[model samples]
Target: MIDILYFAWLRERIGHGRERLETTAPTVAALVEELRARDERHALAFADIAALRVAVDQELTDFDAPLKGAREVAFFPPMTGG
Candidate 1:
Protein backbone atom coordinates (compact mmCIF):
# COMPACT_ATOMS: atom_id res chain seq x y z
CA MET A 1 0.00 0.00 0.00
CA ILE A 2 1.05 3.54 -0.68
CA ASP A 3 0.17 6.68 1.17
CA ILE A 4 -1.63 9.28 -0.89
CA LEU A 5 -1.84 12.77 0.55
CA TYR A 6 -4.07 15.60 -0.60
CA PHE A 7 -3.41 19.21 0.27
CA ALA A 8 -5.37 22.46 0.26
CA TRP A 9 -8.44 22.40 -1.96
CA LEU A 10 -7.77 18.85 -2.97
CA ARG A 11 -8.04 17.68 0.60
CA GLU A 12 -11.27 19.55 1.04
CA ARG A 13 -12.67 18.28 -2.22
CA ILE A 14 -11.87 14.67 -1.41
CA GLY A 15 -13.14 15.13 2.12
CA HIS A 16 -9.92 13.86 3.56
CA GLY A 17 -6.23 14.66 3.78
CA ARG A 18 -4.71 11.28 3.20
CA GLU A 19 -5.35 7.63 2.42
CA ARG A 20 -3.55 4.38 1.95
CA LEU A 21 -4.12 2.79 -1.41
CA GLU A 22 -3.23 -0.54 -2.91
CA THR A 23 -2.87 -0.15 -6.64
CA THR A 24 -1.15 -1.65 -9.61
CA ALA A 25 -0.46 1.67 -11.28
CA PRO A 26 2.96 1.91 -12.85
CA THR A 27 3.11 5.67 -13.25
CA VAL A 28 1.67 8.74 -11.64
CA ALA A 29 -0.72 9.26 -14.52
CA ALA A 30 -1.96 5.72 -14.16
CA LEU A 31 -2.38 6.24 -10.44
CA VAL A 32 -4.41 9.36 -11.18
CA GLU A 33 -6.65 7.41 -13.51
CA GLU A 34 -7.28 4.90 -10.76
CA LEU A 35 -8.16 7.61 -8.26
CA ARG A 36 -10.37 9.44 -10.73
CA ALA A 37 -12.35 6.27 -11.22
CA ARG A 38 -12.96 5.94 -7.51
CA ASP A 39 -15.76 8.50 -7.14
CA GLU A 40 -17.05 11.91 -8.10
CA ARG A 41 -14.97 13.56 -5.41
CA HIS A 42 -11.80 12.01 -6.71
CA ALA A 43 -12.72 12.69 -10.31
CA LEU A 44 -13.41 16.34 -9.64
CA ALA A 45 -10.23 16.73 -7.67
CA PHE A 46 -8.21 15.39 -10.59
CA ALA A 47 -10.19 17.02 -13.35
CA ASP A 48 -7.43 19.42 -14.34
CA ILE A 49 -4.13 17.66 -14.42
CA ALA A 50 -2.36 20.84 -15.44
CA ALA A 51 -3.46 22.59 -12.30
CA LEU A 52 -1.96 19.95 -10.08
CA ARG A 53 1.52 19.28 -8.83
CA VAL A 54 2.69 15.86 -7.62
CA ALA A 55 5.36 14.62 -5.27
CA VAL A 56 6.71 11.11 -4.94
CA ASP A 57 8.30 10.13 -1.69
CA GLN A 58 8.31 13.85 -0.83
CA GLU A 59 10.24 14.83 -3.97
CA LEU A 60 8.50 16.81 -6.69
CA THR A 61 7.83 14.81 -9.83
CA ASP A 62 5.78 14.70 -13.00
CA PHE A 63 2.68 12.72 -13.71
CA ASP A 64 4.63 10.44 -15.98
CA ALA A 65 7.08 9.55 -13.26
CA PRO A 66 7.30 5.85 -12.46
CA LEU A 67 5.78 4.54 -9.22
CA LYS A 68 7.41 1.16 -8.92
CA GLY A 69 8.38 1.36 -5.27
CA ALA A 70 7.15 4.70 -4.14
CA ARG A 71 5.94 4.76 -0.56
CA GLU A 72 4.17 8.10 -0.65
CA VAL A 73 2.52 10.37 -3.18
CA ALA A 74 1.18 13.83 -2.58
CA PHE A 75 -1.13 16.02 -4.64
CA PHE A 76 -1.52 19.76 -4.36
CA PRO A 77 -2.01 22.89 -6.40
CA PRO A 78 0.93 24.46 -8.11
CA MET A 79 2.80 26.99 -6.02
CA THR A 80 2.37 30.61 -7.10
CA GLY A 81 4.92 33.35 -6.66
CA GLY A 82 3.84 36.70 -5.33
Candidate 2:
Protein backbone atom coordinates (compact mmCIF):
# COMPACT_ATOMS: atom_id res chain seq x y z
CA MET A 1 0.00 0.00 0.00
CA ILE A 2 1.12 3.53 -0.72
CA ASP A 3 0.51 6.40 1.64
CA ILE A 4 -0.92 9.58 0.07
CA LEU A 5 -0.93 12.87 1.92
CA TYR A 6 -2.83 16.04 1.07
CA PHE A 7 -2.02 19.45 2.53
CA ALA A 8 -3.51 22.95 2.49
CA TRP A 9 -6.38 23.43 0.09
CA LEU A 10 -5.87 19.94 -1.21
CA ARG A 11 -6.79 18.43 2.14
CA GLU A 12 -9.75 20.74 2.44
CA ARG A 13 -11.04 19.93 -1.02
CA ILE A 14 -10.59 16.22 -0.58
CA GLY A 15 -12.03 16.32 2.93
CA HIS A 16 -9.21 14.30 4.45
CA GLY A 17 -5.53 14.36 5.32
CA ARG A 18 -4.06 11.10 4.16
CA GLU A 19 -4.88 7.62 3.00
CA ARG A 20 -3.36 4.23 2.35
CA LEU A 21 -3.94 3.13 -1.21
CA GLU A 22 -3.45 -0.05 -3.15
CA THR A 23 -2.60 1.09 -6.66
CA THR A 24 -1.23 -0.07 -9.99
CA ALA A 25 0.20 3.31 -10.92
CA PRO A 26 3.82 3.34 -12.02
CA THR A 27 4.20 7.12 -11.89
CA VAL A 28 2.82 10.10 -10.06
CA ALA A 29 0.90 11.21 -13.15
CA ALA A 30 -0.76 7.87 -13.38
CA LEU A 31 -1.70 8.03 -9.74
CA VAL A 32 -3.24 11.42 -10.38
CA GLU A 33 -5.34 10.05 -13.20
CA GLU A 34 -6.63 7.40 -10.84
CA LEU A 35 -7.46 9.94 -8.17
CA ARG A 36 -9.05 12.33 -10.64
CA ALA A 37 -11.30 9.52 -11.72
CA ARG A 38 -12.39 8.79 -8.17
CA ASP A 39 -14.73 11.74 -7.61
CA GLU A 40 -15.42 15.41 -8.09
CA ARG A 41 -13.53 16.25 -4.94
CA HIS A 42 -10.36 14.64 -6.15
CA ALA A 43 -10.73 16.19 -9.56
CA LEU A 44 -11.12 19.60 -8.00
CA ALA A 45 -8.11 19.10 -5.79
CA PHE A 46 -5.99 18.13 -8.77
CA ALA A 47 -7.60 20.40 -11.33
CA ASP A 48 -4.76 22.84 -11.57
CA ILE A 49 -1.60 20.78 -11.59
CA ALA A 50 0.43 23.92 -12.10
CA ALA A 51 -0.66 25.17 -8.71
CA LEU A 52 0.57 22.10 -6.94
CA ARG A 53 3.80 20.55 -5.83
CA VAL A 54 4.55 16.95 -5.10
CA ALA A 55 6.97 14.95 -3.01
CA VAL A 56 7.84 11.33 -3.16
CA ASP A 57 9.37 9.73 -0.14
CA GLN A 58 9.83 13.24 1.27
CA GLU A 59 11.83 14.49 -1.69
CA LEU A 60 10.45 16.97 -4.20
CA THR A 61 9.74 15.36 -7.56
CA ASP A 62 7.96 15.78 -10.84
CA PHE A 63 4.63 14.23 -11.62
CA ASP A 64 6.33 11.85 -14.01
CA ALA A 65 8.57 10.55 -11.26
CA PRO A 66 8.61 6.79 -10.86
CA LEU A 67 6.52 5.40 -8.08
CA LYS A 68 8.27 2.10 -7.85
CA GLY A 69 8.76 1.05 -4.25
CA ALA A 70 7.37 4.39 -3.12
CA ARG A 71 6.04 4.39 0.42
CA GLU A 72 4.62 7.89 0.53
CA VAL A 73 3.53 10.71 -1.75
CA ALA A 74 2.44 14.16 -0.70
CA PHE A 75 0.56 16.91 -2.54
CA PHE A 76 0.66 20.50 -1.47
CA PRO A 77 0.72 24.04 -2.77
CA PRO A 78 4.10 25.40 -3.67
CA MET A 79 6.01 26.48 -0.60
CA THR A 80 7.16 30.07 -0.46
CA GLY A 81 10.27 30.85 1.54
CA GLY A 82 10.28 34.42 2.64
Instruction: Give all candidates' CA lDDT scores.
Output: 0.98, 0.97
Q: All candidates' TM-scores?
A: 0.98, 0.97
Most accurate candidate by lDDT? 1
Candidate 2 segments exceeding 4 Å error: none
lDDT (10s digit) by residue, model 2, range 1-82: 9999999999999999999999999999999999999999999999989999999999999999999999999999999999
Q: What's the lDDT for candidate 1? A: 0.98
Stretches off by above 4 angstroms in model 1 are: none
* TM-score (C-alpha) between model 1 and the true structure: 0.98
Going through the candidates in the order shown, the clash numbers are: 0, 0
